[model samples]
Each structure stands twice: as structure tokens, then as C-alpha cells.
Target: MSTYRLSNQGLEIAEQARQAKRWKRQDEKLARAALVSVATLKRFWGQQPIRADSFEHVCRALGLEDWQRLVEVEEERSLDFPQFAWDEFWVGREKLVVQLSERLQNSCRVLMLAGMTGIGKTALAEKLVLELQPLPNFSRINLDHREKTVEFSAIATQLLETWKQQISDSDRRDPQRLLNWLVSYLQQTPCFLLIDSLENVLRGSEQTGWSEFIDPLWVQFFQKLLAVETSASTVLLTSQDSPAQLVELGQRYGHLYQCCVLDGLTPEEQMSLFRQIGLLVEDPVVCDYLSRIGCAYEGHPLALRVIAGEISQAPFDGDVQAYWKRYGDEIERVKQLQQTAEIEGPHDALKLAQYSRNLRQRVRQRIDRTLRRLTEEVPLAYVVLCFGAVYRRPVPERFWLRSLEGRSLDENQQLAVLDALYDRYLAEQVVMDGDLMIRQHNLIRSIALDHLKNLQP
Candidate 1:
């Protein structure tokens, strides 16, 4: 019984040791992962070296149960970005500004905003900085211009210059010391820091050199800025892609707010935007049709603007179908040119070379594969479906199937083929009259018909 009791105690001791070791490992990892040197970390932690107990104490103080949770919280905080006004170009994302303003007023540490290109992410960021300009403590650093390559040192220098210009400069030359002093100052009097167009900085790094992309100096600067406990200040960042590194920095320093992904406009918003653009559409039928097609185009503001421009220039002549057909052809042509440029390379010389080599190759492969899959040779039903697509109207499946009596397909088989086409993105499915209406985009339809005509003897 005594031996059993001794074994149990040993087991408990071993488990406790294991837990302690795990905690120590995590603490070391977090310290190393931070974008700062030992000295900086020591300074941030009040000149105390991070031992196992001290690390645990720090974790406990931050209310983090584990290192992973701490990391996650940090990442989440860094991804938060303030909403700006200029983001009205895209659909469905104005609420972000209100949320950001609330957070800013509450003195959130970091906000990161992520969105795709042409989504007006930059414009929103700019507007946020403009709004924050009235505050004496507000300062902004816009890293948008492609020509400018900003490093940590450069950014630090800019911050110092901005500080000196706005306030005063007692000590200016030493970046490290200046940054330290700035952090101490910010802790006392909070300020807003805006980092705009991080994509340009990341891309520039890839083009120039990875070493140049995220300089150690910048990392240290961020680390220092983050370490400062400022109740009044918030850092806002805007990027096209995920700012993983920035998030990491935020984790090491302070709380990272939620990330907002700005999307395109709603149907109502698109209509409002059209009205703002000064497009006149008095007829209810035409307006409804325009709204339907506009919504169908995924509420992309730029596409709506393009459609609006086309409509304004060429007023509809009492036939909605004719108007759509005319503009559709022009849009398809422009799309084709754009696609060709993208696929063949942006440079004219390279594009010509690529186009010459791979002309009709993909289309031919698709045709050959499709032909092999069909049980009979070139069915008339398929031909009619393809031909109707050229009209840019949803053709009823039953009408086309009945039109080809001799080449009639099993209903299930016909549905399967349609599904296959849709899956391949070669066709689009729309609902009309409570029936599944399959139609191809004008570009795809034009290409398909051209291929069919060429196949004729």
C-alpha cells in the first residue's frame, strides 16, 4: 500500500513537471515569435527577463489561458481595420466605418481591413485618416505610392519627422531611441497610426528582395509601438491580402481588433449609385430590366457604371432585348481583348507570341472531349441550344428538345449534360417562369457558335 502511494505521488510530480515544461516552452516561443530583440522585449516587460514564472504571470495578467489562445487573440486584433467613406464604390460594406468609429472612440489597439482589388479599400482608408485628422493625437502614414519603398527605418524616420513637425523635437537623430521615446509618449497621450496600402509594400518586397520587403528595423518599430500600453491610441491598417506579419506584430504588442472584409454593393445601393451617376431611366419596364441585369452582374459598382455609361450614350429604342444585344456584343468584345491580354501576357510582343502558339488549342481540346462523350454525332438538339444562346435569351429546354425529334435525348441525360456545362462554367443557369433556364454568357455563346459554324462542311 505504501509502495502504491509512492508511485501515485511520483506520477503526480511527473505530470506537474511536464505541465511546467510545456508552459516554459510556450513562453519562450511567444517571446521569440515577437518582432523584437531581447533588449526591446525586456524594455517592454519593464526591464525584466522572461523566465518561466514571469512568462506565466504575464500570460495570466493578459487573461490568456494558453499561448495558442494568446496568439489567436493577437492575430484577431491585428486584422481589424477601420471603415472609411470612399468604399461606396463597391457593394455591401459601409457598416464598417460606423463599427470602426465606435471602436476608435472606445480606444481599440489595432484594426485591420482586408479586401480584393478595385474594391475601394484604399479610398476607405484615406477617408478614415481624413476623419481622424481633427484629433491632435492623430497621425497617419500612407504607404500607397508604388514608387516609394518604405522600410522600418524609413517609417520610423517619417513618424519622427511627423512628430517633430506637429509637436517638437528634443532628440531626433537616433531612430531606436526616438521610437522608444515615441512609444513612451504615446502611452501617456494616445495617437492614431494609419498604415495604408500594405500590398504595395509586400509586392515591392517580392520584386526587390524579401530582405527589403519587411525590414528587421520595421518589425522592431512595430513591436515597440505595439508594446506601448496606450488607452487613447489605435493603429489602423488596410491591405488587399492578409497582413499575416502585421497581425503577428499586433499579437506581440496589443489587442488586435476584428478584420472587416469589404464586399460589393446591394441592389438598392446600386440603384442609389446609378442615380448618383446621373443615369435617367423613366420607363418602369426598362428600369426593372436594368435592375434585374445589374443585380445579375453581381452588383459590381464598376460594371454598373460601365452599363450606365453605355445606356446613357445609346438610349434604348423601345426594345429591351435589342438594347441588351447591342451592348452585350460590345462588352463581349472588350472582355475578349482583356482576357487575351491577361492570358497572352500584358506585353504586346509576348502576347502575340503566346496567341500564335496556343490559338484554338483549348477550344479544340474541349470540343474533342465533348464529342467523345456524346453517344451520337453532333445532335441537332445541342445545336439548337447553342444557336439560341447567340440570341442572349434563355431558351426553353422542351422547345429545343422537341425541335430535334430524331435526336431527342432522355430527359435525365439532357439534365445531366446541362449540369455538366454549368459545372464547367461554360453555361449560366437562370430561373424563368419557375423553370430552370440555362443560358450561356454572351462571350461563351459567341465562341461556341463560331466553333459549330467552323465544324460544318
Candidate 2:
């Protein structure tokens, strides 16, 4: 869902209502009565973007909650954005949004939206924020593992920056003091903090299946944050792995904590979203194909988006059928990725498989296809990815270019390949200290390394 600005008539009405209010503490009263922040009430009057719920509360607080009560002869529409306008884009998640909004408004102080990468966790977080508009101090922390601190000082620093508050260097130097300052601030004012991709900090060894990636200080910080009872604040975390402490806390204090486990989209959502990206249509002939694509990718939004992006790019140029025809050879691999979610039929092995088996296979297939295609089309890029994966952190562009020594391709070819991979979302590049640093996702890196390992035999 999305927020909308108020209409001109609505703004005028709000102004009139504000002037007509006799009580000096009217704003405070309305805020408490409607569960809307005073600043948000101001934004509504200023014709700014606001949640639908906020709009309703503002209207009700002004005694014009219903459109029929207002003399809106000029503009027929009271609300700037008609209902379900932007919501049309997010398919089949209306109920989820409603539930999430209710939880945030009611009590779930710390909500964790957990799912695999590219499963729309971040998108949902953004949508929820737009729909609920929790509070003023909203900060989205995209967790990066490259900058490992002794005390996760970066996360704390980012949160403080978002809140526009300052802390002494001495306090920041000490982890416990910084955390205490943070908790104290949240205790004072409401805040919405979304920590995305927490797995970077908490993920265990991929091969061994349970190895902590870094010092558990960040984990401890999250635990402390989650345990706090703040009515006005909500901390949302999106992770692949949900820490047991968070779950246990949620179980004990259901109102203050919630662990939301997300899965792939339904077939309808897949097709609806696909239609937006020009990947699917309403035709009966295409219906089966679209449904199959949905199933093959198991309605993973990122996987579908990648395919759509590739189709819109060069070689295919928005020709979905042509793109399929050109790379149709990879259909076998696609099917291979879709195949066998579990060990076998009617076996105890199949019972032991996690629900994310299909999604992991889907991710594996995506990385695998990219690797194999790069090997044939852009071998230099393939080499770069392989070497970049060798280092867990982001690799500098210079390193990749230098590593291309004695190879047939030059720097330009490597750069072009890198661009293609980055654009396709297979590779990620960041600039640190004036040099471009590139890295792949954990799943992609792991799969790519495994592919290399298998080739050695």
C-alpha cells in the first residue's frame, strides 16, 4: 500500500477545523484519540503524504470523518489518491497489510519479517511503512557485513543519525553506553527502525549449517531492543534466520514482539505482478505458461523480476517469447532448479526438509544459470565473480582487472561484463575509499563456489 497527500478541499477543511477548535490542547487530544502523531496530523493539513488510517483519523478528529459531512461541492474526491490506486501494484497482499497495520497500531512493538533473499521482505517493509507511517524517527538499516565493528557501532551510529540526535564520542566508543542511550531515546519518543538482511550478522557457516558470521554483539543489541517495552516504538527486522531469542520473547510477550515468517507469493499474485512488468497477459493460451513460470520460480518476486529485466534488456529487447527462445536451452537447468524440493516421495528425508527448500533451489538455479551463461557469453565476468567470491568482502574493480592477467579479455571487457552482472542483480558493487568494491550475495557465492568445486573432479 501507499500513502497519499490531501486534496485542496480537504486541506481547506482541515484549516477551518483547526481554527474552530476551542480547546488549547486540541492537537494533543486528537492525537491521543486517533492514535496519530501530532506531526502526522500537521502533515495531513499540509497536504503531505499520509497513511489512509491517518487520513481517516484526521477527518474524524475534525468532525468531517465522512465525506458526506463535508461541503465538497468543488472536488468530488476528498482524498487525493483514490483507494487501491497504488495498491493495485502490490497483488494479493491487502490482507497482510491490514494485519500488519493492525499489529503495529495495537501493540507488536518489535516485528520481524523473516524470509529468504528477494522474497519481497524489504518491499513489504517499505509498503508497511507507507501504509502505517509509524512515527517520525524512521530508519532503514541495510546491514552490511564488510564493516565489522567490535561493537556494531555502525548500526547504532546510523540509527542515531536517522533520529537526528548526537552522542558523545566517548559514549559511542563504549557499546553498552551507546545501547543504553538508544533505549533511553526510544523510551522518550516513538521510532520505527527496520533492520534489513540481519543474516549477514547472525548467519552460521553455510557448509556446516550453523556458524556465527561475526561477533554476537549485534545479535545481543537486537535481543535487548526486542525485549524493551515501548508503546510508541516498533523495530522491524528482516532476516533469513530468525534468532530463537526473538521468537521466545515474542512467545512470552506477544504484544511487544512478533516474528513474521514470509513465504513466496501465490500464483495470482505472480501473474498480476508479471502483468505489470509486461511478462504475462490475460490470454488463455498464455495462462498456462504464466502459471508454469510462477510455479517454476515458485512465485519468487526477485527471480521473476530478474527474468523480466533480462527480457527488457539487450539480446531480447522486451521480446519475452524471443528471450525464451534464445535462452530456451537453459530451460533444462530451470527445470532442474525447480525439481525435487525434498529427498524423495514418501521418505523420512522429505519430511526433514524445511519449507524453504524450493526457494533455496530457486535461488541456486538463478545463480547457476547466471554462472553458466557468463561462462559462455562473458567469460571474464565469470572469472571476476569466481575470484570475488573467493573473498567474502567486496572486491575492488582493480583487483579483478589485475587478476585478468594473461587472459584474452581486457579491462573494458571486464568492466562491461561487470556492468551486465550488476544490472542483472547477480553482482553488487560499492565504493569504499574512492575505489569500487564488488561482492555477491551469500547464497550466490556459495552456489558459485560449489559449482567450481564440482568442476574440479
Candidate 3:
């Protein structure tokens, strides 16, 4: 779909017409008459692109007869979006898709999807973007593949160079100017922006505290985006943990910013996904077995996908019974332990056992990256996570905080470390018996317990 803005002459004529009709910038009555948002009204006055229909709405609202004469069709800016291949039949998250779609269209300015690795945040985001009826101009950046020293300035430079076509050398050299220009440009130009793996740009090592942006400018960029009340643009961020800084911004500007914590698929969703992957979930025994595996992994998409592929491939050939005979023990072990209390938990820390070699490798790689960052940057958080693995069920926050007792940390510092785990999504909060509780994912607990012995005193 095409987008249109106002030309210099059109802007002048529209302003005149609007003034004659007593319409003013951000006028609620004008917005209601046009059937558009206040942001859309601002976009109209600012000469930023809006949908052709919305442009017509504004023109009609102003009592302009020649809408075509007042329009300036914007030249489409081609963006290099990431290549994603999705299944023909998407499995689930029907409600999430609807919620995100509506939010992006009407209300949300900065929406973040935060979750553990392989939890399907990116996949769901991709699905939403792909299915957008009139896909707007969009761009994406993979923040994970970058050098540690690279700052937001470099990214700003590339964006300015790409969309704006030309920028002064001084602007490119000055981080503050570049940031200002970029923010201003986004405010006046409607575009969908996606930043993946935001954690990579964060100060996530033991040397640096977790969840703060490594580059201070990044913090400023988000702050500006959230503070702005008039914007036609939307930003989507996918991160393993919601940065504490961004979370604070969301708290302050709750109307403009939102964070969704992605979790595992539901049981029905899990079964649908398995069936789509050509697994024989029709058999009652096989269906029950697959559900057990789903329970074990908490229906983690990537892990479930890998296991399904393994079950469908050569040696097993869609035979769940055969696959279960081999890997069922490992899955059952987790299910059993997860249901047990701390008293009945495993005596020996569960050693790594292969369910599917591919599943283990992928889950481990993703988990290792987070753990390594914790171990390097916030060792206290890492220690806390290791200690947290001892709990089979969700426990009070005090338990995790108390683990750091007798250490050098003060109450504030101790709370900060525990929050670090929460921010990283290594620990999850649950409600039990009307009280809030916390626990780690089964896969995370298994790995953490094995390494708890290795942690220093």
C-alpha cells in the first residue's frame, strides 16, 4: 500500500483551510471528525506520510474539495528486512497476534517482546509483520551480530544515510547530533523499526551490571521515543531480558511503551504444532507421550520443534513409541522432578543427558550465552541463579535474596542482583496460594544445578 504526505504548497493550503475551520494541532474534535488519532493529526500537519485513506480523512475533515491536489505521494524507501521462512500453517498465539496487531496500529509506540531464547518472540513478531494488511515502511537491525565497542551512533549514521539519503559529515561524526537528527526524523517519518537481540548491546557481563545499555546514548534514544506524545511511528524490540532502563521508561510512560514477556506454548498449541510438523499425534499413547515432553520443556517452541523433527526423521520414521523408548526416560525424569518438592528433588545434580543431540546443542548454546554473560558481568546474579535452581517449586522472593546473605552485598545490591536474573528472564515469577513466587525453567534449573558445585565460595 502507498503512503502520502503534504507538499509545501499543500501544507500551506491545508493549514489555511484548517484554520478557517477552527481546527488546531492535536485538536481532539478534529481527530474525532477525521476518524484518526491525534498522532495522525500531528503527522498530517508535520507533512509526514500517512495511509492514503487517513490522508483523505484529514482532507475531508478540513472541508477540502480537491484531496488529490493537496497530496504528495512519498517515494517508497526500500528497506533490507531480514529474510524469514515460516510454516504455511502457523500453530498458535492467536490472541497475542490480535493484541499486538491492534497495539501497533493504534496505541503502542515502543513494544518489547522479552523472553528466554527460543521462546518464539522473533517468530511471532515476524508473523505479525508479514501479515500486516498494508505493510508500512519497515527496517530491522540484528543487534546480536556486532562488536562490543559499536555504539548507537554508528547505527544512527547508517539509518540517516539510508532513509534521509544525505547528511552532513559533522552530523555523522557527532553522536548527539546524529541521535537528535535520527529521533527527529523518526518523529516526522512513519516507519516500523525492529531491533533484535537487544541484550547484546546491553552491559550484560559480570564486569558490568546486567540489563543496562552499554552505550548511554541508547538509553537516551528510548527515553526520547517514550517521552514524545506525538508520533506516527512504532518500534518493536526483541530481547532475552527487558532492559531495566526500558522497563522503567515503560512504567513512567505506560501509555506509550509496553513490554510482553513471551512464554512457552499452551498444550493445545503444542499439539497443533506437533501435528503440523507431521508427527503422529493421533495415537493416544503417542499423543500422551508428546504432551509429557511438552510439559518437560514447558512447551518451548524451538525445543519442541527439534524434538518433533527428530521423531519424524529416518530411524524413528514418525514412530513416537520408538522415539519415546529412547528419550522418554529423560523427559520423564524432568516431569517427575518438576512435580516434586525441594525435599524429594534429585539427590545428585541432574547430569546432561541427550534427548535429541540437536535439541540439546541448540538449547545449550542459547542458555550458555545468557549464563556466560551473567557469569562474566554479574557473577552475583549468576550465583543467585545457581542457588535458585535448588527450588523445585516457586518460592518467595526472599528466598532468592536470602541466598546472598553474609555476602558483601547490601539489601539494595542484593535486590539488584535478584532483579538481574528476573530481567534476564533466567528466573520467572509465579503466583501460588495467592502469593507471588519465583522459579527457573526446568531446562535452566537442570543446567544451573550441575554447575552450582563449581561456583566459588
Candidate 3 clash pair list: 205-377, 206-376, 206-377, 206-378, 207-377
Candidate 3, which segments miss by more than 4 Å at Cα?
Answer: 1-80, 84-86, 146-149, 204-210, 339-354
lDDT string for model 3 (39-106, tens) is: 67777799887766768877888888798888764542322344442333257899999998888888
Q: By descending lDDT, how would the candidates be arranged?
A: 3, 2, 1
Task: Give the per-residue lDDT of model 1 (tens digit) for 70-142.
Answer: 2222212211234433422233445766677677667466676765433456666666664555655556667
Cα RMSD of all models vs. native, in order, equals 27.6, 16.9, 16.2
Clash total of candidate 3: 5
> What is the C-alpha lDDT profile of model 2 across 1-457, one tens digit per residue?
2355667776676667767875233354455445454556566566666665656766776777563333333333333212321332355677888998898877777887876556777778777877874356676667634365434766676678668777778866887776776777776788777777665565323222221436556656656666665546678777655554455567777767777766678887877666654443566755565565566555767766555545544565555567556544443233443244631111111110112344346455544644664565445566666655545456576654654677676556556656545533456677888986876554455555555444333
Score every model by TM-score.
0.46, 0.55, 0.78
**Model 1 spans > 4 angstroms off:** 1-94, 127-133, 165-174, 203-213, 249-255, 281-283, 292-297, 302-325, 329-457
In Å, residue 103's CA in model 2 sits off its true spot by 1.3
Give me the displacement of residue 390 in model 3, in angstroms. Answer: 2.1
Q: Candidates sorted by TM-score, descending order?
A: 3, 2, 1
Better of 1 and 3 by TM-score: 3
Candidate topping TM-score: 3
lDDT of 2 at 161: 68
